[model samples]
Target: MAADDHEFGGQHTDIKLEIVEKYLQRYSAALHTWCDAVWYIDAFAGTGSRTVRVKAKEGDLFEEPAPEYVEQRRGSAKIALDIDPPFDRLVFMDAKPKHIAALKALKASYPGRDIDVVRGDANDLIQKEIKWDGWKKTRAVMFLDPYGMEVEWDTLRLIADTKAIDVWYLFSLSGLYRQAARDMSKIDATKERALTRMLGTDAWKSELYSPIPPAIDLLGSLEREDVRQRAADVAGLERYVRDRLAQIFPKVLDPWPLPPKERPQRFSLFCAISNPSPKAIRLAEDFGRSIMRSR
Candidate 1:
C-alpha cells in the first residue's frame, strides 16, 4: 500500500515513535552482549511509513493555500531495521492485505536481514503461530499499537509467560472510556463483551461504576431504580489498565498519557517488562522512565 493510504501521523503518533525508538536503541545495545538473540516484533505494523499533512502558510491571496502533505516518515518497522547493534530477528504482522504487501516490500529493502512479515491477526500470530520454546535462549520487544481494543488480554498473558520479551503497549484510553459508557444502561452486550475481552475480566463494572441513590416519590412512596454511573474518569480508567497489566507483567512503568497533559487523553504509552529478573526489570524501568520523563 502507498504510505498515504495509511493513517496520517499526528502529535501523538510522533511521540509514540520517538519513545519506541529510544527504547529499541537501548534495549538492543544492552542485550547484544550476552543474549544469543534479540527480536523486535511490530504487532500492528502499518505501512513502513506515515503521511503528515502540513498546513500551508498564509499567502497574499484572500484564501489560504491548500495544505501540503509529507509522506515517507520512517515508522517502527524501519526504525527497528536501522538500529545499531540491531535485533537478530524482526517480525512485522498486520491483518490487512495492503499492509502486508507494504511490510513485505519493506523487508525487501533490507536485503540479507532476518525479517519475517506475517499476515494475520496479531493476537493469533503471537499465541498460535510464533514459537515460544526458543524464548528461553532469546529475548524480544513487541510493540502493540492497535487501532482500538483489538488486543486480547490472553495474548498479553502469553507474552508474559515467555519471560523474556518486553512490551511497549499504546493502549487506547479513549476507546475504553467510551465503550464503557458513562451510564451503565447505555452499554450493550457487544460493548460489554468487548470490554471484558480487552480487560480480561468483568470486574471493571464494579471497579469503575457506582450505584445511584434511591429516591422517594411525591406520593410518599419509596422508589428504587436500577441505575449506575461511571465513577472512573479518564485518569481513573488509565489507572485501572495499569493495574491490570501489573497482574501479568513483573514490571510496568507509569504510562505517559498522550497529547501530553491535554484534556480527554486518547492513548497511554506503557512500557512493561516480562522478565522477572531484578536486573532486567530495573534496567527496563530506568530506561522507560527516563525516556518518558524527558518527552
Candidate 2:
C-alpha cells in the first residue's frame, strides 16, 4: 500500500471519524480553562490518513462512465492535530512499521506540534509502558479503535486509574459474539483465553450461554444436548459490554450503535469517563451524550 493509504471503509468510517473529531474539538476547548495541559492519544493510529475508494455511478448513453479510484482522508490522529484548541501533547501508537513510518511523516508535516509516534501493541503499550500516575494536573482523551479484540480489560483498568482521561472506545460487538461461539464445544483454549482476557472475567461462559432445550431421541427417550449455546443476541451482548465498562469507569454513556439505521449491530461506539469527581463525571456525560445524539 502507499504511504498515505491506510485501509478504511465508506459511510461508517466517515461517521466514526466525524464523531471523534467533534468530541476532540469540544474536549480540548473545555479543558483548556481548568487543566494546564490536555493530551490526545490514538491507540490504533493508522498512518494519520486512509485510502477510500469512491465508486462511480452508471453514465448516460451519451457519455462514458468514470472509473473508481483512491482518495486520501484524515484518520483520527490527523483530526486531533487539526482541532482548534489543540492538545498539548499527542501520542499515536500502532503495531505496524509502515504505519509508524507514515505517522512519522505526518509528524514532520506539523513542525511545531508536539507528537509522539510509538510502534507497539496498544494493550502492552498502555498497560506496561506509560506512566499513569505521573499525570497530576493534566487531562487526556484516549481513542481506542482496536482491530478486533486488541484492547484488553487490564489496559482499560490502567486508563481508568489515571482518573483524568476520557475514553472513546470503538468496540467490536461482532468480534465478541464470534469469539464466544454459539456452540460451547467450539470454543478452543485459544478462543477461551482471548474471551477471558478481553472481558477480564471467566464469567462470560455462564453469562452468555446456556444449555439447549431437551429433545426426543430416535430411541424414544428424552435427551438434552450437553453442549450449551450463546443465549445473548447482539443488543444483549452490547449491553454486557457497556456494563463491563461501567464497572471500571466512573461513567459510561450509552453506546452509539454502528452501521447506523436498521442494519445488524457490528460495532458500538462508547464514551467512558475516567474522571472520578462528581462534577467532572456529570459534565463529561452531558458532552458525550450530546455528541452521540447529534450523530
TM-score of each: 0.93, 0.93
Model 1, C-alpha of 223: deviation from truth (Å): 5.4
Runs off by more than 4 Å, candidate 1: 1-4, 59-67, 222-224
Clashes of each: 0, 0
lDDT of 1 by residue, 183-287 (tens): 999999999999999999999889889999868799967697768999888988999999999999999998888978678899998888999999999889888
Query: Each model's C-alpha lDDT?
Result: 0.88, 0.87
Candidate 2 residue-wise lDDT, 75-112, digit = tens: 89999999988899999999999999999999999999
In Å, residue 163's CA in model 2 sits off its true spot by: 0.8
RMSD of each: 2.5, 2.1
State residue 218's C-alpha deviation in candidate 1, in Å.
Answer: 3.3
Which residue pairs collide, candidate 2?
none
Candidate 1 clash pair list:
none
lDDT of 1 at 31: 91
